[model samples]
Target: MHVESALRTQPRAAEGERVETAERVDAVERAGLARSVEHTMAATSTVLQDFLDGRVRAAAARSDVAARLWADLADGVGGKLMRPRLAVAAYLGIRGGHGDDDSAAIAPVAAAIEVLHTAMLVHDDLLDHDEVRRGRPNVAGATRARLVGRGLKERTLADQVQAAGLLAGDLAIASAFALVASAPADPAALLRVVRLLAEGIETTVVGELLDVTGALSSPRDVDALAVAELKTAAYSGSMPLVVGAVLAGADDAQVARLGAVGSALGVAFQLADDDLGVFGDPAVTGKSVLSDLREGKRTELLRRAYAMADDAGCALLDAHVGRADLDEEGAAAVRRVLVASGALDAVRELTRATGLRARELAVDGVPEPLGGYLVGVVDDLVGRGH
Candidate 1:
């Protein structure tokens, strides 16, 4: 979910060609595209902070949870503002990069997208039993550390952490919807955006069920690709773009086209993210190689590997893949199986294929700037190793 990379990634002529074919143009319309991204990002950040501040004021009496909630979420808000970037880019691209007013107008919806993303991560981390995200203490991890420091022990500590994370996510979700519903778009369009957000959440919940169950059931039974689509594509991928399109007054056909492209791109992005989780450099990706393996995540690689592995390989995976206390040694062993069974290669191919599909659809399915912009974004994301 590298938001900046997707929007900032330009097709060969993304900037200069639009303004001048032979030379890169620095003034007027070319600069507008860059300004759109900058304006939307800054506005989104301000909205997020204001939202947090309002919450703090409203709950100032018992500031404990609110304080920690603001601290944890606000601190992590800078980068990875992926969904908002997509939403704004899609909106501007659909509008042919002409409406700078739309940038300011779209701020609430974009901010809602960012807040919604944070809520998802908080819940996602909780569900995966992942105490860390982006190489830092997630809410659960931070809560646990605080409790331990305060002399709380065992079950009570865990229970308190759970409560904090769950409530924090709930609060964010409520606010996200509020923002979408209140965005300065046509009332009808605003309603559509809100519905899209709700639907995305519903879709995500279904995918999450499959994902956590993925750890318990046979890996072969889980449709790993479908799971990725459901979990990440709905809210994280297409919803933002669709929301933007709706706000921009795109027609049904165009909205549908963008949605499909978003879906393909979202799935591709998740696949890349999963790959990074397992194999990327933590220093570069801010993710760990061990967490996904330890979670026994039924990633496409794991599913494909299970199908492709021999008995010995299966036995090796069964031993170390899901253990809570799994260490570097166990992770290495799983990686060995992934590589040996060609699951790594297979997943990588699928990632590229998915990204390519999105680009193909975008080329003729949408307008020029959007089509070209998404093409470049997908290319960069697909090729990005970290």
Candidate 2:
């Protein structure tokens, strides 16, 4: 029922990694994906999660401290697995295989992406001084809370919490790389996949450093949008898509186009997260509205607001935003400036623009059902609050 040509990559693919080619394509296709996209993502998520759980438990068994630390770290693991889902879609789309087809080859990389995402989030929370994530106590937060309950105070509490977060994040990163390396792919393809991970980490590290040192301090410095792309879009967005397509034996042009599609989506996703940080209800977003304002996160929204605001609006932002003692009243005042200055709406428009761009690119870059599917992915991504 499938065209032989559909199973072959362009001539350029032969110059790179060896394509699975037509002889084996039908066998691979028949081996899995007898279902649909939903089944594919669900199966992929299951595989990676099992890997994460098994590896984590094995490591935790090594010591009491390891067990306690990982228990706290595990609390951060459950999420939408958006990264893994995207990777699975790209793989199936390129390979012309469906859920349950050729899954053994894709599972490790998919799981690796999710593990890496958890690692980045853990480190990001520590850097941001966040005490909660996904409606519960995070690694640093849960540990710090327990310590406080036991009467641990001041520098001692800070010291212990930081150590726990750092170690846990390190373990996840190590495991992610290891998992991907173990994927059953060509040596060349596997190397490329591993390189993507390393590059993502490199880009994210700079992004985090810029954010911590105050990205908005100088007009010459990197803007918040740039920071968001580097920090989030690189690893969380493009890299997942790239890894999936690469394993599926896509050509260079296809790879680049898919990367572009993912970058656009990733940027949109980050911008939406920026909006949620200020405006969304904590009950739904599971994150504090006050943290972004109190931390004075240099989001594009905040930048636009400062640029468009009246002197009075500027004065209010300067006073309450970034104040450690900032309460609900101060936060409300800051939110007012964000609204009155029209920056909130502007950022929302930017998010929409990015999503639209991704939709267009998806049509041009990806194949039939896959392109349509990614367009739907874009729609949901931009519309999300959490």
Candidate 3:
């Protein structure tokens, strides 16, 4: 998916008041993830939007369209804090109880999750060569028009787009750090959280590099499990929970357990994402189906299928995997190959097993109420969008 899709924040709450709040975490699950996190994220979104709006208005006054673009950009990047909620859930798991004060404390950390997500999207879009995002044009997409308007050639546009996207990724990272720094956690703890954020970024980058390298290499040397765990799983599942737990003053053992939960959940979530990348509803997912196929992602499915494919099948796949123009028919053919080879089932079984592990880990050392809530959340995340 493109940066726009990745950065599309949750919708804003209604104006002139704080959004109506949901009482319990179960209430959130019942309401559906987008809505649950929409309400949870609404308050913080309002603040971020208002700030961006004011900035945009100021820029418009000065006739600086770039400023307006920047502000508008921020508005679009605000969204659901699914990963960060993992963090909050982890915190609650360790804290063993809840109240008004506890809820208030968790909010900022949750918001920080969104911040980090935004950073990842900005970078992912650049890497993917996507010009659009979240059903709208991205910074690069928007710039295309301006570039054409300025009489730039298509080749020049390509160069500038890539460069600008790289810069945008850097800016997104800066913004994520600012958000985490601005939260109400203890100074020392916040510093550690920030460090963790950096570490997650590094891990994700390494995964991305490996993924790209595998795509281009003759032998496709990377391990599918390693790629899935690092690129998609750890950050989205484990890091957020661990960070939240750390923020809530979880002891080392509790924090470690939360990390374990996150690791397993992250793997399951990534596997589900892989499945959805092939099989999801276009409307709900807000993207074309089989996007990963078109992108030639070196997912577990691809790796497993490749290994099992006969020489003829491997030769057929080698020609197909990285083709940007792979169409619906091509993707379907690939699905057929995966299914016939049993690779898809293998990946699915892996997802189910890992999800079970996550649930077990999530509850192992926590207080009852929060642990139960976390286990539910882990379950929700594991098969999400499937």
Per residue, candidate 1 scores C-alpha lDDT tens digits across 1-386 of: 58766766666447756658532432344356656776767877787788777766676667776777666765554566778988888888777655546656688889988888888889998887777776678778887877787777678898988887888788778988887766767888788788888998899999989888877788877898889899998877788889888888899999999999989998999899889988998877777788777777888888899999999999999999878899998888888998999999999999989998999998878766667667777887777775
lDDT of 3 by residue, 1-386 (tens): 68666455323433212344423543554334334333444555554555456556765787675574565356457545578666656665555434445555556666656756766776678788877788777767766656777878779989877766666666657666766776766899889988998899999988888877887754345586788788877788778878878887988987788788778877888888778888778777675665677787777778888878777677777767667888878877777778878888888898889888887875577655556666777777666776
RMSD to native for every prediction?
8.4, 8.9, 12.9
Q: Which candidate's lDDT is highest? A: 2
Cα lDDT, model 1, residue 375: 79
lDDT of 2 by residue, 94-130 (tens): 8886535567778878888888898998999888777
Segments of candidate 2 deviating more than 4 angstroms = 1-35, 149-153, 215-222
Query: Candidate 3: where is the Cα deviation over 4 Å?
Result: 1-40, 50-65, 96-100, 218-220
Model 1: lDDT of residue 257: 93
Q: 2 or 3, which is superior by TM-score?
A: 2
Candidates sorted by lDDT, descending order?
Answer: 2, 1, 3
Predicted structure 3, TM vs. truth: 0.82
Model 2: lDDT of residue 240 = 89
Collision pairs in model 1: none
